[model samples]
Target: MTRPTRVDDLPIRDELRGQHAYGAPQLDVPVRLNTNENPHPLPEALVARIAERVTEAARGLNRYPDRDAVELRTRLAEYLSRGGVPIAPAQVWAANGSNEVIQQLLQAFGGPGRLALGFDPSYSMHALISRGTGTAWLSGPRRADFTVDVEAARAALAEHRPHVVFLCSPNNPTGTAIEPETVLAVYEAAQAARPSLVVVDEAYVEFSHGRSLLELLDGRPNLVITRTMSKAFGAAGLRLGYLAADPAVVEALLLVRLPYHLSSVTQATALAALEHTDTLLGYVEQLKAERDRVAAALAALGLEVVPSDANFIQFGRFADADAAWRTLLDQGVLVRDNGLPGWLRVSIGTEAENDAFLAAVKSVDVVTKKEQQ
Candidate 1:
């Protein structure tokens, strides 16, 4: 007997390169609400600043960017301070994106027989990344409303004794945050039973009425908050995201990361992004206003709209959400279909775009998709 050749001879992990990681599509779509990206464009002034800085770095491309982006770290620490979660530059570390940042956290703390844990219907990336690290991932069951069950979470913690726990506030897909007390309880349970790192992925926090657990981090050394410029800041294309944790923990991450993990051009762009925090935050306010409007409209139309604290709304009562997802795409108003088979997730775009999506929904007899299917 002999092993198969070529593709068949490759490692299973290598074979997974072209496969879906978190069910996100890479195709170009007119309305891309499916990816939870901010619809706002980068401000002109900020663009100019980024251009100036990137041009300055053109001559330095022959050499690597600072293995540690010290200037960017200072800006990020100041940014976090303004948001009420005070931090220092020494406490922050970043990678290409929050996706990779989380991967670093996993590599430092999880893999093999070790376990990674999270709550159900939360960020799918948590489970995807955990498996990519060769770690066993477990989750507590979700409630009827799709939030995690606190008691179930405590039990899961006791059982899995996970090395890392990903807690996504204003959790993806469902669009509701885990309550503060709920998060606190989980932290206490984990600390009592085992040493675990609890990471709060606050990637969408700016759009969520400014509520964050970063304030709870001082005494909770085991907890960390990860942020991304991809959401409300409209920097997804640049792929910049960071982690804020104790210096000791940050040192652990720094030990394993590659030199020049973020390019000089990328660093220049992020530095410019920090300068426009106020302008970008104004956009977040606009999105929150739109989020409320969309939720109310969906409720009026007899859909069960989840009370969302994030920039998107999740509605129940679809006859077939998958078909509706395709219909929305055909109409150039793409949104995610989640929360079981008969629910949909719609991102809050600019008013004009939101109007177009709402009108498209009203025009369609959604049941038609089911009939055709």
Candidate 2:
């Protein structure tokens, strides 16, 4: 056997080693409850509208898109406020997607000497991004239930004085929403320190009962709320993301944004997607329904599941989550295995998909019992 050049060997940071992310199986299996994606596809009417708009915009492909992405930002400002978080068009800006939005936040706030503080066992991608940029990374202990630790977070803000502090509500993997008051406490202290950005990564806001901080926009120049069309809008392919903040912060993002960041096709497709906002919302309700129903069924199977406000559920304490993950895959079901040892995350799928996952778990239970003999 000969050794091939590793991706890490190509003049990259030591962090970029052979070890990679643990992702859900992306197969077209009988059921897929992984990656926290909406099980439903965009409605037919909306899909048709997107097609028409994209074709119409194709004629103008030679022309560059608006670097400022004027109309889309206006639409988002209005959409984000539909629930709460009232924001004006002038205060909003968007990028390729929220992942990019997070990176942009880091670029604008983080640098050589500056540190970035966020909760541990939260979004693993945050650690990856912060580490890649050579910024000092600091972590706060999350509560046992995975909610953001208010006192701990505040202390880190005071101690490290990190340039950026990330708060992911209805956070990833754990699927728990940090209380708004808990997040605000960090904001109050971070603002007093000058030039710190508190980003509320509300990537899964549609399913949450608690409203976004969009309405709390005014007076706090340091606050930024991040959102995405990928999750609720069924526009994952569109690579669209938006950030709400003061005009000054929005302007800074524009400066660093790749020129004409929003493609004409992307804008046209996104605008079309917005036209059927109700269709997407209906899907949200369906997924919420599935989340509750499936969680109950899993509990009945003797699995302990974390209380979730988002689309996914985290469950386990089995001796091995990886083996359980393999069992699901064997039965043609797939889910996300998380950072927490002995825990796996399952996204809410359709009725049929839910049934398939249940069946798989049933088989696993029977097998474990037999092994006891």
Candidate 3:
């Protein structure tokens, strides 16, 4: 038999040689709260509307999708403006997902020899995408509580003077939202170092306890806010993400965007989702309530829980997080072990699903106590 070739057998980018793709475990379980996805299914009305729009788009399949995605951009702008920021279409850009949007930003602003910096334990993709784009990555500092150490961040900016900076509001895994003052301070510090592009990953902003940072875009040409339909819209499968930024930034991104990158079907589906925004947001309210309920339940279990502004909660001070995760899995519940040492994360599922997860946690506690005895 011929020997099987391994991935390392062929020459590949040295940076990607040993890298693992970013993902949570996708397992078949009764209560799966691993991925921070909106637990609610889209309403029937929205589904019907998506069908209608997609059907219309099918008629134009022979032709290319609007290369600039003008209509979709306009609708996205309108949706964002509802937050009172008055965003214009020219200042918005959409891509397959926030990942693609992040890649485009890196392609335009970060490349070989340039550095991109993000506080530790942020959206990992910031560093991953930087490496993918041939950009150097720098890890900045965060407080022990998972909040950005603003002064330390300023100092990092001064020292490295990276070309790009990434800030994640309502940061993942930890579920901590950055304060507006921190953002402003970082932006100022980044600019002081050089005219750096400061990108804010606001993918969870819709679920945040605080307001969206869109309003801060005024006169800040280097500032960009990236958002996604995957979370609040209950449309993770939609794969639509957009960014609000200065017009010039949008133009720069155009320089690197592939022609007609977004397919017609995606634009139509996203358009339909926008039409039913109110109904979808109603589900967001439900998730927010459920999130709070689950957080309280977890804290009541005597576990350490990080105050979250996203749909997921980060809880634990487990001596062995991996063991705790496996125990939950054994109990037919799945959650994320984000490699945060003593912590594990769980997305807020439906009321019943959350109840099951609580029960599983209680069981784990019982087992641990018995083993000690």
lDDT of candidates 1 onward, in order:
0.82, 0.80, 0.92
lDDT top scorer:
3
RMSD of 1: 3.1
Of 1 and 3, which scores higher on lDDT? 3
- Model 2, position 335, has a per-residue lDDT of 80
As a whole number from 0 to 100, the lDDT of residue 58 in candidate 3 is: 99
Off by over 4 Å in 2: 1-3, 14-24, 192-194, 366-373
lDDT of 3 by residue, 1-373 (tens): 9999977778988877888888888898899999998888989988999899999999999999999999999999999999888999999999999999999999999999899999989888999999999999999999999999888998999999999999999998788998889999999999999999999999998889999989889989999999999999999999999999999999999999999999999999999999999988998899999999999988888878999999999998777788889999999999999898878999999999999999999977666555546
TM-score of 1: 0.92
Ranking by TM-score: 3, 2, 1
TM-score of 3: 0.98
TM-score of each: 0.92, 0.93, 0.98
* Segments in model 1 whose C-alpha atoms lie over 4 Å from true places: 1-9, 13-19, 26-30, 364-373
Error of 1 at 362 (Å): 1.8
* lDDT per residue (tens digit) for residues 1-373 in model 1: 8855754346776424454646755556666676777889998999999999899988799999988999999999998898667898988988888999999898888878788888777788888888888877887677888877888888888877888888888888778877789889888888877989999999888877547777888888788889999997889899999988888888998776877788999998899889999999899888899889988887776568888878788875667677777777788877786546778888888898888878777644456444646
Q: Taking the candidates one at a time, how many backbone clashes does each contain?
A: 0, 4, 0
On lDDT, who's better, 2 or 3? Answer: 3
